[model samples]
Target: MVNILPAKEIYLQGNEHALLLLHSFTSHTRDMKKVAAKLHEEGYTCYAPLYRGHGNAPEQLLQYNVYDWWQDVMNAYQFLLDEGYQKISVIGISIGGIFTLKLAQLEQLEQIIVLSVPVEKEPEQLKQRIMDYAYNYKNIEGKSALQISNEIEPFTNMPLDSFIAFQHFIKDTMLHLNKITIPIAIFYGERDEDVYAQSAETIYQQVQSSKKKLKGFANSKHLMTLGRDQEDIMKEMMEFLRMNNGDLTQ
Candidate 1:
């Protein structure tokens, strides 16, 4: 059995307006910490949860389904609500973006910011990514070459139910985009692949939010927050929030 690696879940107390940040697939909350910290510096409460089965062995990832992650998202949102933050927004990237859209469908969110989302189906690529994660993760764990191959070989061609469920969840979220009426800002990196750019356009066109903005950073890519245009994108994000009742100087 793979032991769970320790993860750092961040919560910075600042103001009544809270921001919930979600990370990508095969990632931890650290990916969103920079954005959360940036917002916290401006007097905003920020919480980024480390999802279950993540920050651990890649094999452990296969043990959890999309349902597990959804519960994590719900719990994170509920934590904010219980903290007396009536107004809450979400910023999600990749799989986190998927959750943000799904959350908007049922939750009373103030607004949403989605980055580098893959709204379309990507089962094959996802499967390959899982395999790659497993290989790289074992290497990081200091496992020998024989051990890594032995561990990954069993699941290389096997049918993974978690990934199938994840794809279904994405498709399910796409059908419910019209349910979201809050303001939305979708951003992508010009340096990223065509899939992300197309996904951004799809989200912009499909969400029922009347106030939606779609922007691309010239020097950024899929992981926009860590790209060269990170500062510029964050500035634009703040501006978008300020325009949409995010002037939290209160």
Candidate 2:
């Protein structure tokens, strides 16, 4: 049997300054749910869009590339801009953070926040594990193999094409890091299992933005938004936005 869970978009209306929240690769809008709620309470309109091929059947994910996901992010931002929101900020987690950095090179916005972004290439061992799981999905001990696999990692499997696309995306995004002059804040987990701990500092050093901050959180893993320092992370994001006057012009 298949697990046909519903994946919904999140939109909260508040002030003029809107925030576009992006989830990690293979993750649904649910990853940004809590953060969106907090930012909404802080009087900022927020949107969390579900990326293409995500929150669906695992095989369907193979149909998309990193550019497809970036298009989804652009659509969400355009929706806000069309709705008369002038001041816009973007907050991203993991792969979402990579996308945010990519967008920083392309667009001029209010500010950006990248949490636990991978500045370097992903390990081949990890990619192999995902490919292995995809190959053995039916043999897994579960009713819904895809769903069960997603419980372990956001995506049940990683297709070779998508993996390659991610590598290219990272390489391309890094090449233009000097183009980002907008205020940016980065957060990293000291004990992150997926990304290296030094990634935050690496990004902090690469960007030409004078207004930048690198923060490391203790006792948090790859899922920094959902970890022990969740509240603290939210507070820092809120403070960062406010410092940029994101609370004004409402």
The model with the greatest TM-score is 1
Residues 6-44, candidate 2: write the lDDT tens digits. 578899999888899998765678879999999998888
Q: Estimate each model's TM-score.
A: 0.93, 0.85
Query: For residues 161-235, what per-residue lDDT tens digits would candidate 1 score against the true structure?
Result: 667777889999998888989999999989998988998998899898999999988998778888898899889
Q: Which candidate has the top score in lDDT?
A: 1
Q: What is the lDDT of candidate 2?
A: 0.80
lDDT of 2 at 60: 64
For model 2, what is the error of residue 130's alpha carbon versus the real structure, in angstroms, after optimal superposition? 4.7
Counted clashes in each candidate structure = 0, 0
Tell me how far the alpha carbon of residue 85 in candidate 1 is from the true structure, in angstroms, after superposition: 1.2
Q: What local lDDT score does residue 210 receive in model 1, on the 0 to 100 scale?
A: 93
